[model samples]
Target: MPAPVSTASALPARALLACSRAYCAAAPRSSDICSSLEEQWAKIVLVIKYLGSKRTLVPLLTKLVEASGASTGLDLFTGTTRVAQAMKTLGMHVTSLDSASYSKVFGDTWIALDGETANHSELVDAISHLNSLTPAAGYFTQSFCIDSRYFQPFNGERVDVVREKIASDYSGTWLEAPLLASLILAADRVDSTTGVQMAYLKNWSHRSKHKLELNDPVLLAGQGLAVQGDAL
Candidate 1:
């Protein structure tokens, strides 16, 4: 299979410049702000490789939002929170609402890290510490690996060990959201899934053979809220 193409090249220069021209007044001039946003969007590490992720469409959506003169965004069905995250990156105060518990975790992670320099520094460091954890056997491994071939035993064991550490140590802290999000992202990377969790591939995917590794979220400084509730 071919290496995956990034979502960055989705927008044409003409359209991107048009978006810059129509952007909000509070931020920098068109070219400068557009360049910054484009740079940031390219580097962002979305926490999930979800089935319905709006990752590719975010630029268009944000451009529309900017044209409307809205400085805030409400994503009612924020499945992977990618759109909400994009809006936040575009300097909007965003609220990502979804019924899924995991959606809330993705939202919460962004909110927790979009803080002062000191707090942001501390949070990232603590979350990064999860990488040092030793892999071990546990329920996640048994359920997702042994019982079902969703992930390799190596990656599954790492997820279990890290998850247990997150529960026992990082629970109730700001670290919880990003830490769990990182673990889930790591496991998903090495998973033998056909995108959704409904079933795993009969054979290990090339990606599945890789060891899991947590990636620290790229911090975007702005106001954000993640609510676990219906649109209503």
Candidate 2:
């Protein structure tokens, strides 16, 4: 009867080395892992702010995908679609799923949009105009920031104006996703939260005090699926 090998330290030196080598061999090579990480990081750099975003896990997830040699992927709880966007950037067909309307907009804009129909320069100009529009105290200002302080009242007013403009002018158009995503990202940039909307900081963050500005979303070129439904 052999003594029970209850711990890894009980293994013979040669057995330990062999196990280590086998583990390394089964894992993705260092270079492949690095490249995958870089690729995934690059994709999510453009994603809009969302609660529980998995942007930080992109590198680890990418390495796992490379090790598995998966050709396609699905992000079942694709909040803001950061992971799905990364998979699409890796040339894997991706399907993004989220129950929230805002997340669906992110997916449609960043992953599923057909950009050829709209002129890029025109969209940029439109965003620039929205950024320059004067802020006014409105619903968002009164509702979220003036009393609640979720954002500086000035920025919140600007958010309201831009949102109303988009709703009136770009509603149901191909430009809607890109334009709306731009606003959402801009608003997130100026929000006074510590990364979520459940509470606001007692004082405004410096970033929140700056004038709000919108940047064009980096739309990917490809056909993908954006589904909004319960994951369960």
Candidate 3:
């Protein structure tokens, strides 16, 4: 008889799909993933500071979805779209619904978001270009850096320039949503807020000092609809 295969996760509970190098699902709430969100099968990582993110529950959730034997599933309250992303990996037609605009980007990037598709390598190059642009002080810098303490002045300027470039070039196109999503993920790494974004810290957190960078968002191939609105 053939030897039994181990069903355990290859990476430890803390080792999750990282960005080209990217965020650790197991890392502290204060740090950012250095690379981009990239995953291979069971190795999925999404680092968002939400009190209700189900990222850690994905392993168990995947098992449940597998047992259901259903081809389609509905994630009515997709908070961070983590479960929905996992369900899609199971080859199920998944629908992720949330009321937040950023959720739409997550839905498009991980789920079946509407948008123009590009070659993966080309997308990488585009991300590189975004990173190369010179950062400038814009409304984002003044508001988030000076007015508020979400990010330091250095990283805030980086955020501003890159976002302005993306807005100018890809705004209103399918590319726009995912690109914005990518920026959000990158910025999340260096922000000073205490995860929920309700407010900033009295002092800059340890991770808030890192430079802002954009990385490739792990793109999943599956069928699903990203809905933005009231779940009701």
Clashes of each: 0, 0, 8
Query: Residue-wise lDDT of candidate 2 within 1-232, one digit each (tens)?
Result: 0111222322454354455445556775765655554444422221222345576788999888878888888999898788888888777778899999998999888778755555799889889888888887888999899779888888888998999989998899788888998998788777775423336767555567678889987778666888999988
User: Measured by TM-score, how close is model 3 to the native structure?
Assistant: 0.75
lDDT of 1 at 135: 86
Supply the TM-score for candidate 1.
0.74
lDDT of 3 at 167: 83
* Decoy 2 TM-score against native: 0.73
Question: In candidate 1, where is summed lDDT lowest over 10 consecutive residues?
Answer: 41-50
Error in Å for residue 94 of model 2: 1.2
lDDT of 3 by residue, 1-232 (tens): 0111222422342254323333454554534333223323222211223565566678998998899899998897786688888888888899999998888888877788522354677667778899999989999999999998889999999999998998898787666766788898788777776434446878675567778888887777766888988988
Candidate 2 Cα outliers beyond 4 Å, as residue runs:
1-51, 115-118, 195-197
The per-prediction CA RMSD against the true structure, in angstroms, equals 13.9, 15.4, 11.5
- The superposed Cα distance between candidate 1 and the true structure at residue 7, in angstroms, equals 20
lDDT at 230 for candidate 2?
Answer: 93
TM-score of each: 0.74, 0.73, 0.75
